[model samples]
Target: MLQTYAMVVNRNKNRTKLSTSSVEKNINVVNTVKNPSNENINKMEQSKKPAKRIIGTKIMEHVKLQPDKIIMKKKVFCLSNVKKCHRDDVVEFLQSSGINVITCFPVIKRTDENDPKAINNDEHSTMFRVCVEKKDEGKMKDPEVMLQHIIVREWKFNEKKLDFKNG
Candidate 1:
């Protein structure tokens, strides 16, 4: 019955890190359980007895359990569909998801080849593609789950725009 723990560092003493050798010295000793009835159990139990006293001096300093006080930079997934999302609805969704940026790609318009930048030019055309992705925060399964939620919530066709903003 041993719990493998890291060496506790005295923050007030100005220690930035635990001694690396401490971890190296007892690699196989931590978290190992020996059956009390086993012949070698006595030896294992005896070996760990001295380490038990230092358990309080050792602290868990792993990343998964550590607290993150700093603001995390969120990565927004740029989603594009055949239609565009309503600005107000998009804003609301972003607010709910804590998304700082909603990157939107422009819808490609079909036009004649007179303009070099026309859609007829394969190189210049823009087509919308929605990329299902995870929320900036929280425990969403994956992009596929996000896509399913979007489909279920029907955010793709929530509202229609009457006029296009001229750039």
Candidate 2:
């Protein structure tokens, strides 16, 4: 069980920035103490985590789990005619069979122009694909028992039109 921690900084440290101008009869004290708007709080440079998931053991540190646990005998399986709703059910069934799910994603229904910069390209896949690692001997359960009626087949890697550019 790896644990991650983020630095907790006190945003309440920098109290109201007091300033007095000779031109004004009254000093304008920007009371950030109970200010309804917290615009100033965010500007303080204490610390914050990135808004995205990090890959490796960053210098800040966390007890990271070793990457790529499925070292050998990895298998890719394709589940056909799977809807978005039944996706979880399929994964649960597979896990019950004593296999570890390495990666699972839907097959994009639309075709890409092989352009990474393409704006309108989207995924509308009606099927789901999963890369699984077997528990011990890498044996898969029978297809008939999975989700009552779902076709399972081995997914093979195929060369795309612009494999180099996209890959």
Candidate 3:
């Protein structure tokens, strides 16, 4: 059977209700004689219809691909040495501590001369995500609340800890 099956798939099914005034909703089917050679030729010609290209308008121009490079400049801290120390004391200590008072700050990949260079050029980059650290006083005031803040607001994540082979 040689019938033109025109399936005018509506682009906006839910966003725009298809009123009788919106689109010229019509189906035109024409059946002709059955001929194998002619049908195959027709199908071949149909396949050459440029694969239904989507040409965007001037206002909706194609977007350029974004580069993988990212900069992480936000400051955050990681608490350390809690044994034999009270929570409030620790928070206070961290806020006004001594030299090199170790706390986690965001660090991007730095290629120093002493370290081995990345084997894959594209794969290895010094890009890091922004991280947020709550104030020590805010955290100590409500531990659970601070934890929730960290869970929700913290942007930096441990990417190296992922087990890629299993994944």
The TM-score leader among the candidates is 2
Q: Give the Cα lDDT of each candidate.
A: 0.42, 0.59, 0.39
CA-only RMSD, every prediction:
22.8, 21.2, 23.1
Residue-level lDDT of model 2, residues 1-167, one tens digit each, is 99999999988787764465544423223444456245655654334435675445434436465456424446788778665444566567677877677766666544644645333323334576777765422445465456656667778788646555653
| TM-scores for every candidate against the unseen true structure | 0.23, 0.40, 0.17
Count of backbone clashes for each model? 2, 0, 1
State, as a TM-score between 0 and 1, how close model 3 is to the true structure: 0.17
Query: Which ranking of candidates, highest TM-score first?
Result: 2, 1, 3
Give candidate 1 regions above 4 Å deviation.
1-76, 102-167
What TM-score would you give candidate 1 relative to the actual structure? 0.23
lDDT of 1 by residue, 138-157 (tens): 32223542443342221244
| Displacement of the residue 80 alpha carbon in candidate 3, Å | 2.9
Query: Which consecutive 10 residues in model 1 have the weakest lDDT in total?
Result: 124-133
Q: Give lDDT tens digits, candidate 3, residues 113-144.
A: 34544333323222222223433334434455
